[model samples]
Target: MGCSKKKIKYELSKEFQFEAAHRLIKNYSGKCINYHGHMWRVIITLHGHELDEKDMLIDFNELKPLKKWIDKYLDHTTIIWENDPMLTFFKKNNQKYFITKKSPTSEHIGEIILDKAIELFDNQRIKVKYIEVKESNTSSVKVYSNKY
Candidate 1:
């Protein structure tokens, strides 16, 4: 009988911060419901087994596109729920913002990032392990993918 084999894996992480604004748009008891901004921090982790001809699980340079995408969409922009009426006003005022179906809380933002990351990395040949989002140094959340 042949023995099963285990493959070694390599992981790569990229972390960055961006400024954005959001309001809970809910009947909650906190400042999240009011307009505010944060220097949000995000970390992206990728896992892979096989390396390309370049002997790398993934080329770090390939992450430039992700950085550009984040800067274009999330940096210094307001994030809002799709159903939030503020979205219409912001659009009409020609402001930059990202609309999501989920609430823009720190934890939910982590979920949103993970959801988009799967599609964003479809052609990268690497599986996303998790995404960690931090609203502040003392507050953070991580969303893991089942494939991880």
Candidate 2:
């Protein structure tokens, strides 16, 4: 007789890209202190043990709204830490900007995206697993959800 175990896990992922600018405000940094922009790439993963009536983890179309939200708010916008002094300048000039409570580093950005995904999709059957944010081709950060 052979022992066998049941399969009980599934995962799905989605990728999105946006162009944005940010600066490290309070931390000791180098050239990044100056305003700069990058083509940001984000990947979100979702995990679940149960499938829906359609026999799928979740329809990829369900994630389109998340991409739409990012394109509307973060694309081509300067992301600024709420406490940065330059915020006043951007506000005065009426420039497009997004404010974040924490410094807008790649790691925190991943966390922010993860939080958004959880808010949009998390439920009793499915949950967000992690988010990977790539600020450059060779540099990236993966932030995991604390809920799981």
Best by TM-score: 2
Question: Could you give candidate 2's per-residue lDDT for residues 55-137 as a string of tens digits?
Answer: 89899999998899899889999999999999999999999999999999998888788888899999998999999999999
- Check candidate 2 and list the clashing pairs: none
Q: How many clashes show up per model?
A: 0, 0
Tens-digit lDDT track for model 1 on 37-74?
99999998988766678988678777677677779889
**Clash pairs for candidate 1:** none
Give the residue spans of candidate 2 off by over 4 A. 1-6
Off by over 4 Å in 1: 1-7, 122-125
lDDT of 2: 0.91
Top lDDT prediction, candidate number: 2
Model 2 residue 34 CA deviation in Å: 1.0
Worst 10 residues of 2 by lDDT: 1-10
Question: Which window of ten consecutive residues has the lowest lDDT sum in model 1?
Answer: 1-10
lDDT of model 1, residue 5: 23
